[model samples]
Target: MAMHPLSDTDIGDIHSQLRELRTEHHDLDLVIAHLIDNPPPDELLIRRLKKRKLLLKDRIFLLEQMLVPDIPA
Candidate 1:
């Protein structure tokens, strides 16, 4: 299906979401690092956090792509 062009509001919303997701992703990175450095870390928790971070990264990438208008070469 063809995609509709994003309006100013839509772009603004996406920007807001991107900011939130990026912040969360960064926070998760710090948390993961902290968890790893401390004594024995909980593998399960770390794995779950990493998975969540990956999902956030994917979402951030998709939103960023949306902001870029498609141009015919």
Candidate 2:
């Protein structure tokens, strides 16, 4: 599928969004680690955070791919 041309502002916006997502993902990693390392009383919260982290990972991958044009092998 062909993507529409993006203006400079659009690229910048995506970059900003990417950074925000990465930061949030990293924070989630820390939180999950702390929760597991300390063995929190609520396992459900940890599970939710893990699930959210997985989703953020997927979104990050997708955005990165969008920025990098694929080359024909």
Candidate 3:
């Protein structure tokens, strides 16, 4: 997936988003770890964090898809 068509601003935006997503993922990891260590987690908080992690995963997937050009048959 070539990035030539993307303008500088577009590339910058994507980079920024990726960074933010990574940061969020890292934070979630810490939370999950803490829950593991402490035991007896709050169901609601766990569910919410898992949902957010999935959402971020989807966003990252879409961003990656944007880099790939569609092939015609």
Candidate 4:
């Protein structure tokens, strides 16, 4: 799909959001690893973190999809 016309500021904002999402995903990975290493982990916390990670993944996918150029077939 062709990307909508985004102002410089809009592009900047999307980049910033993408960065934050990646950082958050990395942090979640650490949390998941720590939980796995420790027995009797907090199930609720792990569940919440996983949900947040999934949300970030979805957002990143959307942003990436927006960046893809539409090809004429």
* Residue 67 CA displacement from its true place in model 4, Å: 2.3
Flag the better candidate by TM-score, 3 or 4.
Answer: 4
Q: Which candidate achieves the best lDDT against the true structure?
A: 1
Task: Say which prediction, candidate 2 or candidate 4, comes out ahead on lDDT.
Answer: 2
lDDT of 1 by residue, 8-68 (tens): 9999999999999999999999999999999699899999999999999999999999999
- Full candidate order by lDDT, most accurate first: 1, 2, 4, 3
Please give, for residues 1-73, the per-residue lDDT of candidate 3 as tens digits: 4345777798778878988998898899899778767868887888888899889889988886765665755
Candidate 1, overall lDDT?
A: 0.96
Model 4 per-residue lDDT at 29: 97
What value does the lDDT take at residue 4 in candidate 2?
Answer: 72
Candidate 1 colliding pairs: none
What are the lDDT figures for the candidates, one per model?
0.96, 0.86, 0.81, 0.86
Off by over 4 Å in 1: none
Per TM-score, the best of the predicted structures is 1
TM-score of each: 0.94, 0.86, 0.78, 0.81
Worst 10 residues of 1 by lDDT: 64-73
Model 1 error, position 19 (Å): 0.3
Q: Where does model 4 exceed 4 Å of error?
A: 1-3, 70-73
| Candidate 4 local lDDT, 1-73, one digit each (tens) | 4556777787678888899999999999999989978988988999999999999999999876665556678
Residue 55's C-alpha lDDT in candidate 4? 96
